[model samples]
Target: MSTERRAPLDRKRVADTALKLLNEVGLEGLTLRAIAKELDVKAPALYWHFKDKQALLDEMATEMYRRMVASAALDPADSWQERMLKANRGLRAALLSYRDGARVYSGSRFTGTDHAREMESNLRLFTASGFTLAQTVRANSTAYSYTIGFVIEEQGVKPLPGERREGYDVQERARLLAEFPLAAAAGAEIFEDYDRHFEEGLALIVAGVESWTRLG
Candidate 1:
């Protein structure tokens, strides 16, 4: 840690420090005072850049989203469906990068140039693919919601001891099957192969858009 203080504290610097501290303290423990201590400044100093803690949180969310948008690639050669799959996967990966990242990202307002540009380009791709403007909006919204919601659930599940990727323990699964064979069998589908689950879910959304557009 540098004893020399960074000059001219800014919103980005403050938010960046908050994100770093978030990994250590988690969201509930994060506070303006905590952020100030990380920057080696007094708590009141941050109020110069952010009106309140919520304002700082909003900036933190926006900065995360900006990075998400920046990482997505829109290749013209790829089919619109393929591009969309990449976009959704990329979004999920971004949200999962930090501790409680999805929560921070979903908490903020995405009212900035990066978000606007990404939205415009995605709309153009959908429209160019023969979907009506309304259909495009619905498709995009559904895909975005699904990705974020899935990540929220994904992040919420804690890994159990001796378990890989948050599933029932072998003994627990056997016990569940013996007591509630039918119900457990049905629920098993929801608890396995998360990567495949996400891909198949995204495919259904894309397929629904294609099918609905053709019907119109």
Candidate 2:
């Protein structure tokens, strides 16, 4: 009789497993019990690492942030605007990687001080680019808020890539808005090509920040 010996359980192991299961069950269905079942452990085992679901979510968000940082390809030679674009694009990609990923990351706090490093880097970038510390905070916050809000809406329309919810069909939307010609014609723009739309919006934000900085 052969038996399998599982690896020891830890917070990282639990969080990693939870991220995987997130894609399958989504945030709404994900629970400590579900994660424990997937890890082949009891629910109480998770409590030792995470006192509650919110704690688990915080770890999951931190893991997502870590992966985003690892996969980012920020060029040192690029301007601050370019860096903002790259960073926010990476953030959007990270949030869209898993089902309800944005939801998981939206309000969750990090379990560690890992985010501080990136925060410091961004602050330095803006301050060096002639933005006051206050402006730096506002600019970064605006861009970050835009990215998060965009992904939240994007995910709401399509929970997973290549999968959109009902009632979002362009033609159906057009028909529903038939009485309003302009609104009806806008369906395709609103419902399709999120990538292009995101880029355009990000560019606008960068430009706005530049103008705001110059004015100040």
Among the numbered candidates, top lDDT falls to 2
Cα lDDT tens digits, model 2, 1-216, are 659888899998999999999999888899888999999898999999999999999999999998888777446677788889888999999999999988898889998998887788888877888888999889988999999999999998999998998989899888988999999999888889999999999999999998998888
Off by over 4 Å in 2: 1-3
| Model 1 spans > 4 angstroms off | 1-7, 158-177, 186-188
The TM-score of candidate 1 is 0.84
Tell me the tens digit of each residue's lDDT in model 1 across 6-78. 5678888898899889877777889999999999899999999988878888898888877776766567777
> lDDT of each prediction vs. the true structure?
0.78, 0.90
